[model samples]
Target: MSNYRHHSGYCGIEVRDMHPRIHNFTYVSSCVKYMIFMLNFIFWLFGGLLLGIGMYAFMDKWHSTGWVRLETFYDVILNISLVMVIAGVVVFVVSFAGCLGALRENTCLLKFYSMCLLLFFLLEMAIAIMGFVFPQNMNSFLEDKFTDKIIHSYRDDPDLQNLIDFAQQEFKCCGLSNAGYQDWSKNEYFNCSSPSVEKCGVPYSCCINATDISSGLVNIMCGYGVQEHSVAAAGKRIWTNGCIETVRLWAERHLYTIAGVALSIALIQLFVIYLAKTLEGQIELQKSRWAA
Candidate 1:
């Protein structure tokens, strides 16, 4: 009878010990892990595509130019090819780490992905704060240096030239410079002193009726020598207003939409970071259980 009682007590204690405590639980949530993995996988594919396209564009530009002379870091940052390449690389790396880490249950990759996202979020916040605090300085910089760079570099790069043309046509405004359509004088071919036939002329994109209605053909020479006339006279032929003012007005009109998009991006970043961190925690917990 005494041996039976002792064996029964030991069996009861062993049963109690087998009950799972919070830290002892080894269950890994597949839902959270797979959700993070799928979202990151989609982003990874997009990033890869962007990276490939950016690489091709950069290489082509380099071959055509023979050399790139960037006077400052700002110049390098402003370069379309370099900008696309940098953005692509960042997105590709971050998304790759996130997806692989989540799928493989890797703590190291998850940590890296989370860190990058956090850093990006902080940087964006800082830029936003600076914009709010230094609106005048930002506006001055855009008006002076940025516009000058775009206008002068327009003919140097086909992509840039097309982008400027599209902006002018869409905004129904001429140059981004303060002088408006007269800013064409800064271009070599359009300069008043230039011997080219396009001298003192704005691009056809600035013309009001550059396309024929019946034939549906564009009149490429519509803006020829338009800038040589007075503003009152030229106003009848081409858009006389500067793109800067037009863009400012457009922003004012679409302020809510812009804000909503920015907020959505921020929220998405936060959610991704959260998911990454949660998966990291779960993996760590599982590893701890294994160790115990």
Candidate 2:
């Protein structure tokens, strides 16, 4: 009789432990689902942010250069940004819906959201691939726009010769003296140096002594010239080239990184969908068993 009583006590203890164990699992499962939903939502937010930045860049400066062919190409790229914005919005909405569905263990909504996510992910991959592949052409477009600016600036500046003389003195070259001219050569030293190398042997450097007040004054007072404008133009060209080159390099270097992040987000969403589906099946099974 005592043995029977002890066995009953043990069985009671076992049943009590089982309830808490099952309850703990239920709590953990709920937490996991919430975490998965939150992750999907965060990735959706990231996509939206990128889309916004791209659109801002497309619309801000690039939109103003419509007179240049490069600007025209930049405008064309605006379409790509627009598409990204649309895609991001769609993904955000669908992912938000998916999160809600996951939280509620709704199978149909989960499936729909998964399909949308997959479609958009593929679309983004295609766009990224295109950007990576045609980076050189894009860089050329940026370069052309910058070169156009230089050419325009050169044409517009009336005091360009003075500017060139001033810049030459700043560089500490011999001015017209270095060009082997007793007086500044009318044709060769008109703009500090000859444009045609064949006509003038070596161009004169523009260094003038302070004691030689006339040459110094001439440099200071002269209008903008080819040398000054060309220097400025070259600087602008280098900056534009560097900007385009950096962008191209980034696209090339990070093509796989971008794709991987995108794909990882999609995979995570898929996993969440799967987990939600499994939970839905379990809930149904529990209902049937309870009814039985």
Candidate 3:
């Protein structure tokens, strides 16, 4: 008599627990449990992929995560990678716990998963706030790091060399010293002050336009002696100014987009945490009903 009864859902304005107080009745729907399980499964699948990629990138950049030697100027170079790896590790672990909980319907794993999600959500929101509030800190650090020292030490690391070349080409700027590829002087081969064979030469990245983008058709000589000419004469031949000004300007222009992306990530994590909490609550309620 208590388990079976007739009742209308009150104009389709359903009440989940109104009858629980009136009749001590409870409902545990397998559909809701399965839905939450599947959601966690999907979330973990994508999270695993992101985690793997982030770890790979971090390892590749530092060779070993042990002691990443960044001189004083390069100290902040690890900031981005460190945050990403930390976030990636947390997401992976939470997702693993979620997978175990969903598959086994274990209360302990679900509780851990929910708690981890909340903790990570709060941490990310804090970081996003700091990132937006003081974006200049990052910009200044990068401007300092991307100086003539890179050109002088470019050959020391293949990764650093590639990054420097990419930055010059993308920003359409040149040199550590002044404009018109004079910055090339910092490199031994292009030391115009010493009058070497490669003196006054610029890398192909400094040209107004590349001969080939796909194949990187470099006129090693295209940059040759271009810095010897006056700025007016070199206007058509090579880029002027160091990357600092242009890159800073670019960051200023795109600052809003960067902040928006950070906010969006925070919102997504908040939603995920909400979902985990709701599922945990529902599971607890279902357990109570089963015991009754």
Evaluated with lDDT, which candidate comes out highest? 1
Instruction: Rank the models by TM-score, top first.
Output: 1, 3, 2
Q: What 10-residue stretch in candidate 2 is worst by lDDT?
A: 174-183
Off by over 4 Å in 1: 1-27, 62-75, 128-136
* Model 3: worst 10 consecutive residues (lDDT sum): 17-26
> Residue-wise lDDT of candidate 3 within 1-292, one digit each (tens)?
4544455577976444434344444343455456557776776776777777766765776674454555664443433454455666666677778777756667788789878877777887776665556656754654466555667666554455676678788889876433436667778877787557778777777778757588867665667787678877776877877776676578679988876887797787676666656666766887886777
| Superposition error at 63 for model 3 (Å) | 12
- Give the alpha carbon lDDT tens digit for every residue of 1-292 in model 2: 2222222345466322222223223322566567658876786787778678757744643455432123454334224444566666766777777677667766677677756766766786676555667666655655555433422232222233344334344444322221222122234333345564323211222322233366544232222232334334423311112223544555567778876887787777567656656655665665565566
Sorted by lDDT, highest first, which candidate order results?
1, 3, 2
Q: After superposition on all CA atoms, what RMSD does each candidate show versus the true structure?
A: 4.1, 14.4, 8.1
Judged by whole-model lDDT over C-alpha atoms, candidate 3 comes out at 0.67
Alpha-carbon TM-score of each model against the true structure: 0.85, 0.39, 0.58
Model 1 Cα RMSD, 1 decimal: 4.1
Off by over 4 Å in 3: 1-91, 105-132, 145-153, 175-202, 212-216, 225-235, 241-245, 254-260, 287-292
Distance (Å) between predicted and true CA of 171, model 2? 28
Best model per TM-score: 1
lDDT of 1 at 31: 91
